[model samples]
Target chain A: MNYRGPGRVRAEEKPMPEILHPEDCIVKVLRSCICGSDLHLYNGNVPDTRVGSTFGHEFVGEVVELGSEVNKLKLGDKVLVPFNIACGKCSFCRQGLYGNCHESNPEATAVGGIFGYSHTAGGYDGGQAEYVRVPYANFGPTVIPEGMDLDDAVMLTDVVPTGYQAAEMGGIQPGDTVVIFGAGPIGIMAAKCSWLFGAGRVIVIDHNEFRLEFVKNYAKCESYNFKSIEDPVQFIKQTTDWLGADVCIDAVGAEAAGSAMQTITGRKTLMQAGSATALFWAINAVKKGGIVSIVGVYGPTGNLVPIGNVLNKGITIRANQASVKRLLPKLIDHVQKGTIKPKALITHRMPLRNVSDAYRIFSDKLDNCIKPILIPPTVKE
Target chain B: MEKIAKGIPDIKDWGIDADPENDPTYPMKPNRTDEEQNGYTWERSVQQAETVEILKSTERPNLSAVFGTSVPPKGLSGAIRRYAYKNSEGQFSHWLPLLIADRVNVVEGIIDDLKKGKVPNIYAEKGFNAMWKYNRKAAIGMIAANVAAVSALGLFLFRGRIFNEGKSVKKALQNYNM
Candidate 1:
């Protein structure tokens, strides 16, 4: 699929990949996902989201061919690849900080390599096609464990780890009230994981009624439509008896919808990098000396934020790309133990050829689509 | 390494001839044309009457067998090296493990290229570049930090002479005494 322009995508036939390096292997893609981050590119929100580039960061595949130097796998190994393309021996990878890998994305300094995101993230073609060249196959691809559901493994690639990390960064204490801003898949996952971190109360805020209801049922947390509430911050303060929640999470990111001024300045006019309405709310709604964890992504440029409030309130803000490789082992255990239901988020699955239709449904929020997966035509159900 | 193809003759003269009149390190002067000097003498290059037989050794040269496992420092020295690796985010610290891993990848990449009858440049294949060239902003920041640090150190060391200049040691002492 080629990203022709904003709101335009078309499928084009491309040649098969050959061995570029000894560590490279070709994987026949079985499953790929259209992530919320991809919307940033599809909607022309991210810079340098080049035309004619495939966009997908979450995928699972079968290793069909291996380069001469690939030692970890044989032919026919079904693997789950992390979204981040990190060389295992880099300093960041050695420190379990694979998201900031040095060698994989030598083209830029800001971000490590990410598959199919954009040029700012190494410019590697993603797994949205029938086949993709898996660089550093030995290090990146993990064999799907026996009897593990493929859907669960695919979510483990990005959504589960990111959500888990959001909660982990919040450092939720026992009896602490946590407010998650967003009812998207990651936000829902964060709300669910907040319970594991000993949060006494979990409240998810979003404007979408469908997603709000979905999170309430799936995450088993309190959900509220921000549009319905007179003032979200004031409501939260009143509910907590004027003492704000202990932790606030911003899972909404740059493409947030809320305040009129923010929408005008951020989304419509392109004055700010992205709509930071959720981040502003999180900063205002958190208790003094509380934590504000941000897994939401912002553009490369600066954005309007409440820095003074954060400093005065003594808020410890922690943000980072989820180190998927580092979290995979523990998350796999969670999936096996039935502690997390990652596949429940998958509301739509379409063939890779119908990707345009899939994107439209997901982007428009039609039919209450929370998550969408793309199945390559080569793979049978 | 895999042996060269069977049909290809091994050249006897791998090293250039030395000029006795000049320094031993310097090779003989090249006067012949490019084609004449390095002509492809496929058949005659392999001398048939050589008495020295090539030996196929049974045992492989193992570094571990020759010199046991690496000797890790057990005292303060080891702690200091570990601390340096842990605290520093410089290129040296970042490149150490990558050097080890890329060494094998680079070699295999070269070997594969050779098998396919292509000359491989390891530097390009490995995507290796100096830190300064790779990240100029970081390099400039490091250079600026070093300059500031050195200037501060110089000021600290020469503080008395620099700040208390124009006051003679004897005259100043006498004034203080009076």
Candidate 2:
């Protein structure tokens, strides 16, 4: 369908991409997801959502064609495409930092390249289409294990690993106190990963009662509805004996929910508290000498950081686009071992042709949809 | 005496000869100069007296502490020779085991690469550089392998004689105890 404008779709015929290199593979998309980041492009809030740019990035597909050097994967093999394009041999890719691959971007200055961001990434088409070309296919695509649902594995492409990274950056160690801000899909997933990592207390803060319930029941994390609580940050600190949370994750980026991060982190500057505190709160809320990992999506303009607070706190900060290639294998193993059931996070599923409707329903929060998996209509039963 | 003379030829090739032309004697005459000839005569006389003294001392080994592992007299010519050869060769020979181990490690690495695929040019270059950097190690490994092979052969050929020598040492010790 041609993207004419916001909320408009039209059927248009376009040439399918062929294998241009020995490492390339053509995939027939099985399942795809509408990311919150994609909503930015769809709503025209973020620039570069052009007429020809395909929309989705979180996707699972079957290999339909393989280039000469594609030996690891074969035709008919099911796989998940990582959101970040990586060459697998570059310095960044070698260190499992696939998001920052040197070759994926045309400019070669920045380390990361996002799918569907033509100006930011390599301008390679996205997985919203029936077929997509994957460069360095063996390194970029993760083969889904047997008996795993394509719907469930699709989240591993972007959100699951992203959430996991958020938890990781928050220093979510076993038996450590953790507070996760924003109970969105990513936030929920981050909370779940923290629980899985064995956090002693995983407290999730959000205004949405439904999301809080989901986190409490499904993720088995302590939930706090910020609207219901008189003082959410103080309450959490009081629960942890005023030491502050050992780890804090901010799943909400620079959105309205992010304003609460300062309060959650005890009024610490976003940078001072480090990326970990920035993950859940502003940098100031982070414990001294603690780690902060920022997994949330920042605007192209970037956030106004409190550099002084970060310097004073001596908090270690790390921010990166999710490296799904490195995280997918471990997440898959966890899923196979029944350590994590990402399927529980899926609140809705609709056919690919109905993706526009699904987007509206998800965006509008209709029927409390958290994550809606989009299955393409063309797949055979 | 005849056996010693036959061994002397083999020893000369090992850089231990004492003759001027065949033995590489010191104070070598460039063109048989008169001064060099006189100096050579004096050195030979001094060396001959020293050799006689060494032979006399060996008759009473217990009285000669230098003949045993005990420290030799400082600045003695023979003592200096013993220290130089023993210390240098002993310290240098210690590297043999390490060299052998490294070579084994390299061979294992090469075998692993061969099993995977043809070794890349980069790997080959790395291997070449590694060998160049540790050439002395490689030489020590070669020497160790040679020594091991020679020792094994000697043990196989002189097994009965080796046993006899062990028995003789034990008997001598027992006699000393009595």
Encode model 2's per-residue lDDT on A1-381: one tens digit a residue: 334333333233457867666677899988888776665554433322334456678888999999887888999999988998776655445556778665554311343556664333444567776887887776788788889977778888888888877776564444666777778788888877775554666788877788889988867768987667766666766777765677667676643343555433322332212222234353545566655556666434324466776688786765677878777777888777776678888888777665556665665455677888777667864
Candidate 2, DockQ to 2 decimals? 0.00
**Interface RMSD in angstroms for candidate 2:** 40.1
* All DockQ scores: 0.01, 0.00
State the lDDT at B174 in candidate 2. Answer: 100
| Model 1: residue B5 alpha-carbon error in angstroms | 73
Model 1 TM-score is 0.68
TM-score of chain B of each: 0.26, 0.23
- Tens digits of per-residue lDDT for model 1 on A230-349? 589998898898989998999988889989888888776656667899999999999999888898887665678899999999988878888898889988988898878899999989
